[model samples]
Structures are given as C-alpha cells and as structure tokens.
Target: MVGTALGLSLVLLFLSVPVFLVFGLGSGLVAIFGLNLPWSTLIQVSFGAVTKHVLLAIPLFIFAGLIMLRAGVARRLVALAMAMVGHWPGGLGVAMVLTMGFFAAFCGSILAAITAVGSIMLPEMKKSGYPPAFSVVLAASAGLLEALIPPSNAAIIFSSLTNVPVSQTFSAGILPGLVLMVLLIVVVMIRGRAFSRNERAGWGARLVAVRRAVPSLLTPVIILGGIYAGLLTPSESAAVAVVWAAFVGFFIHRELTFEGVWSALKATAVTTTVIFSIIAMATFLAVVLTYTQAPQHLTAYLLQYGIGPITFLIMVGVICLVLGTFIEIVPVFYLTVPIFMGIALTMDVSMLHLYVVFTAFAGIGLLTPPVCVGIYTAASVANISADKAFPQVPLFVGVGVIYGVLMIFTPWLAEWLPSALH
Candidate 1:
C-alpha cells in the first residue's frame, strides 16, 4: 500500500500536478485500494496541520519579507553590500552573496531573498560586466541562505514538527550558514577575477550608502538579537519584524504606501495560502502513513536488512536531495519530515540533531537540478539559463553536505542555542 501510494505520488509529481493534488490523489488511492480507512481522517489532519500556533510564523515571515521588499529595503541592502564588497575581486558577485545572506537572515525565505535582492542585484551585475551565468549562479546559490538564517520559517516549521527548540535550530544553523557563505564567496572570487573591472565609487559615497541602509541592515540584529537576549519569543520577534518592516517602508523609506501595503498583503496572502495548503495536504498524508503503520513497516524492513541508523540517515538525505531537484523546499519539508521523523525517533536520534540534518539536506535541494527554484529564480532575474547556473551547484552542495555531516557527528551545534535558551 505504501509502495503504491509512493509510486502514484511520484508519477503525479512528474506529470506536473501540484504537490497538494498529488498527495490528495495518493491518499484517495490508499483509501480505495490499499486500506479501508475512514475518509474523514484526511480532512481532520489537513485542518489540524494549519491550525497549529507555530504555523502562524509562516505567513508573518512571508508578510515581513514582502514588506521589506516593497519598502525598498532590498535596494538599500544591495547598495550597502556593493559599497562594502563591490571593490573586491568579483566584487559584484560578492555583493550579491552578502546581500542575499543579509536578507535571508531577516526574511528566512529563499524566494523572498531571490525575488527581492536578486531582482535588483542580478541586473546590476550584468550591467557591470559580470558574466550573466555567474551572476545568475551567484544569486541562486546565495538565495539558499534564506532558509539557513534565523527567523527562518523553515527552521521554525522543522523545530515545531520535531518538537525541538526553535531557538536551538536557529543557532545551530549559524556557523553552518556562515561556512556555506564563505565557500560560495571563495568560488565566486576564483571565477570572478576574469570579470573584475574598475568601479568609480569613492569611500565617501560608500559610506553614504551604508548610512542609508543602516535601518534595513539592523533588521536581523533586531530579530535574532532580541531572541537571543531573551527579550522576546520567536513569535514575538517575528511580530516585531513585521511592524518594523512596515514602519521602515512607510515612514523612513517612504516606499510602502497604502497601495504598496495592499499589494504586499495580496502577494503575502497568495504565497501563504499555497504554503499552508501544502502543509494541510502533507498532514493528511502523514496521518494516513502513520495510521497504516507504514513508517513502522518501512523502519523494520530497513533495520531487518541491516541498514544502520547512520546509513538510514544518509539514505534519507540522498532521497531528499533527489526530491529537491523536482520540488520546492516548503512542500518537500511538509511531505518528507513527517515520514522521516518517525524513523529518527525509532533510531533514538535527538530531535534537534534530526532537525538540523534534515534542514541541511533541504538546503542542498535548493541548489539541485531541474526544479531548483532558487536557481530558476536567479536565472530569470539575471537573464541566464538554468543550465548555465549548474556549475555553481558543486560549491553550494559541497558546503551543505560538509556542514550536514559535521552536525550529524557533533550534535552540540544543533543543541547549544536551545539549551542556552532553556
């Protein structure tokens, strides 16, 4: 029954059906052909998934990102990044990476970082004589940091689902995220020398750019700092972010008007609805899998065949990497995490460790092939092809894998922050 449902789901996904639709169809198939489960369980699970308090973070984070983008925060950030890094070798690419990382820290959504920061930086890089392919690749790779940084909706979701402390998940990601960014910068620098050219901005001008962006730049400090300082909970910090973003956009930046607010809200609503819908569908699928004891069966079969826990984890990572090539991160999380959580628990894996490992794997998916959403987004913004963006994948994926392995071996990285919070 599990095999049939899995096969049907994959087939539907390959045929380009929406993820939620595929899940619903697979669940129906299981009900009709595999099991005699009541259909009403599906509705209950779907509703329950979205109704959780932790799920509130998703829409708020999305809305905050939209507000930042609408308020010209991306422009400010890019200008500041360029001012600081644009004079370096492959400076424009470096600026893109830095700006993307910065935005990711606050917004916690790769799509938001790519659309907001990439939209501005990609064109600038092209105009500045950076290779279009490099520009696109850089933007795409940098965008993945959105999920790595604190206040990330993905981190929040993973923590909530795994019952790990969200604060710990946020901190566990910090060093790994930094490591990945450094590797990305190195790759860009090595390839960037060929594209390096002179820019005319003086120190004075650069300082002025920094001054203009200070408010926007402080967004992350406010969010993460407040959380770390124990001044607010993650949810409260997210609320502060929304209010701060709105204030900056409307009053300080003067970019967010009534119409701008409406547009941002509409955009936020559409994205939030899509994400929550997938969550609902995945919830139902999870219930079906759990009720049918499919996870238990699979775990027992794998263990019976002599697959060790580490081997199982590595296999799970590999599967997620493959799925990521075809699907977006949010849906992948929704579908895969529940299935894997059961296995991790059976293996006595620490919830924090599992969350970090899974997140690292998910991060890898953001850079993988085919439907690599980050790459596609960066490519579109930079006017480059997805195939051209492939070369940059090695650096990004390498960093992600390295960090994932490190976190797996040394559980402290994933546990320290949350422990401190307690």
Candidate 2:
C-alpha cells in the first residue's frame, strides 16, 4: 500500500496535477484499499488539520500582508531603508534586503513580500544602474526572510506541528534571520559594486524618511512586543496585526479604501484556501503512513545502521533542499517531518532546533531552480523571465548553505533566543 501510494503520487506530480490533489488522492487510495477505511475518515482528517488555533494566524498574517502592500507601506519602508543604507556600494541592494526583512515581519508570506517589494524596488534599482536580473534575484532571495522573521507562517506552522510555543519559535528565528540578512548584504556589496551609483541622503532626508516610516515600522514591535509582554498569544497578535494594518492603511496612510479592503480579503481567502487544502491533504498522507508504521520502520533502519545525529541532520537538510525544489515548503514539512521526528527524538536533538534549521534550508530551496517561486514572482514583477534571474542564485544559495551549516554545528543560533526568553 505504501509503495502503491508513493508510486501514484509521483506519477500524478510528474503529470502536473496540483500538489494538493496528488497527496490527497494518493493517500485516499491507501486508506480505502489498505486500511479498508470508510470515505468519511479521509474527510474528517482533512478537515481537522486546519481546525487548529495556530493555523488561524496564517490567514490573518496573509491579510495583513495584502493590506500593507496596497497601503504604500513598502514605499515608505524602501525610503527608510535607503536613507540608512543607500549610499554604500550596492546600497540599493542593501536597502532592498532591509526592506524585505521589515516587510516580512508583517507579511509572513514570502511570495507576497517579493511581489510587494520587488514592484517598488526593481524600477528604482534599474534607474540606479543595477542589472535587471540581479535586482530580481536579490529581491527574491531577500524574500526568504519572510519565513525566518517574527509572525512567519513557517514558524507558526512549525510550532503547531512540534507542540513548541509559537513565541519561542518566533524568537528562535531572529539570529538566523540576522545572519542571512548580513550575508546577503555582503554579497550585494561585492557583486553590486558595478552598479552602485546612488548618492547618500542627508541626515535631514534620513530623519524625514524615518519619521514617515515610523508608523509602518511599528508592526513588528507591536506583534513581537505583545508576545514578549505576555499580553497576547501568537494568533491573537496576528489578529491585532490585521486590525493595525487596516487602520494604518485606511486611516493613517490614507491609501486603502473599502474596495481595497475587499480585494485584500478576497486574495487572502484564496491563498489561505490553497495552503489549508495542502495541509489537510498532507495530514491525510501522514495518517496513512503512520498506520502503516512506515516512520517506525525507517527510524529503526537508521538507528540500526548507526547513523549519528550529525549525519542524520545533514541528510535531512539535503532531502529538504531537494524536495523543496519540487514541492511547497508547507507540504514538504508535512511529508517529511513525521519520518524524521522520531529519528530526531531518538537522537536527542531539540525539535525546535530541527524545525528552524530544516525550514531555513527549505526556504533556500525556494530560491533555487526549476520551481523557484520567489524568483519567478519577483521576476514577473519586473517583467522578466526567471531564467534571467538564475545567474544570481548561486551566491545567495551558497550563503544559505553556509548559514545552514553554522546552525547545525552552533545549535545556539536556533536555541539561544527561545531559551533566554524562557
């Protein structure tokens, strides 16, 4: 039954069927034939996956992202970031990275960050003499911060699956996010030298930009600070983010309208549905695989073969990177987390650390070839093919790999903040 389900999923995936359906139908087949389960079981499992309180944060964060995008928040963020970094060699690239990091706090959705910031920054970068492909690639790679920063959907999902506190997961991501941010800045400084032509803004201009952006900049402060202050749960913080985004966009920024509000909600609904569907279907697959004791068998095999924790972790990172190129990170998490969780537990690895490291690696894969969603989204914003942005992927990916290695060996990189806060 396991072999049959795996075979069917591969064929459907190769044939270009939607990923949700491939997992759903393949697992449904296993439950029906192998377990002799009734159809209602599948329905129940699929529905139950999205019924969690933590999952509620996903849609709320997504809604906030759209609201900020339409509210001209990205423009203010770019201006603020430029005022701080735009005079250096590759300053626009630095500003792009910083802007994406700031936006990632509120958006949490990577592709949305790429689209919002890319639309605003790409044109400006082009006028500053930056290469079009390079600009797109930088934007896409920077967007990976969306998964690592606070209020991240990936962190929320990781917390849900592992039973860790969402706030701690959010905290766990801070160092890694900062590391990646600095690494990206260095890369931009080196590669962006040829096109670095922007003049430094005066202190007066910098202060003005900062003043204009203060309201938009309060987003992460509100969300993370509320969590740290014990005033709100992660989901509650997400709800507040939505309300704050709406208020800022509509009343303060004065760029959002009733129609714009409706549009953001509609788009959020569609994206939420797609993500929830994939999670539901992947849950069904997890259920079927558990019933077959597949994870148990694999865990025993690995243990018997004397696979050490370091070796196992490295292998898991490789699998995450490879699978992530072909699948969305959420589904990839569902598909592999079960099999690896037992191994992780048996080896005495911290589940929180494992999740953070693996999620970061998977995010890096999103900027890679064949199915680089971030690259494609940002490239489209600039009216270019993904291939044009392909050349810039290697350097960013190298930095990602190096960071992954550091996380693996340094463990504290993922554990310190959460522990310190505790």
List TM-score per model, in order. Answer: 0.91, 0.97
Residue pairs clashing in model 1 are: 168-418
Model 2: per-residue lDDT, tens digit, 159-270? 7777888988899888889888999899999987887557889999999999989989999899899999999988899899999999999889899998989999898989
Local error of candidate 1 at residue 73 (angstroms): 1.0
Q: Give lDDT: candidate 2, residue 173.
A: 88
Candidate number of the best lDDT: 2
TM-score of 2: 0.97
Clashes of each: 1, 0
Q: Model 1 TM-score?
A: 0.91
Whole-model lDDT values for every prediction: 0.78, 0.87
Compose the digit string of candidate 1's lDDT tens values, residues 1-422: 76777788899999999988888888666864567767676777667778878768777777888888889988988888887778788888888888888888778567778888878877777777877766776677777677777777778888767776677778877766676678778877887888855475788988899899988888888888888888987878888999999999888998898888898789889888788777777765676677688777877888788886688778877777777778887777777787778778888776776766777777677678877777788777776678887876786677677766765677676667667666
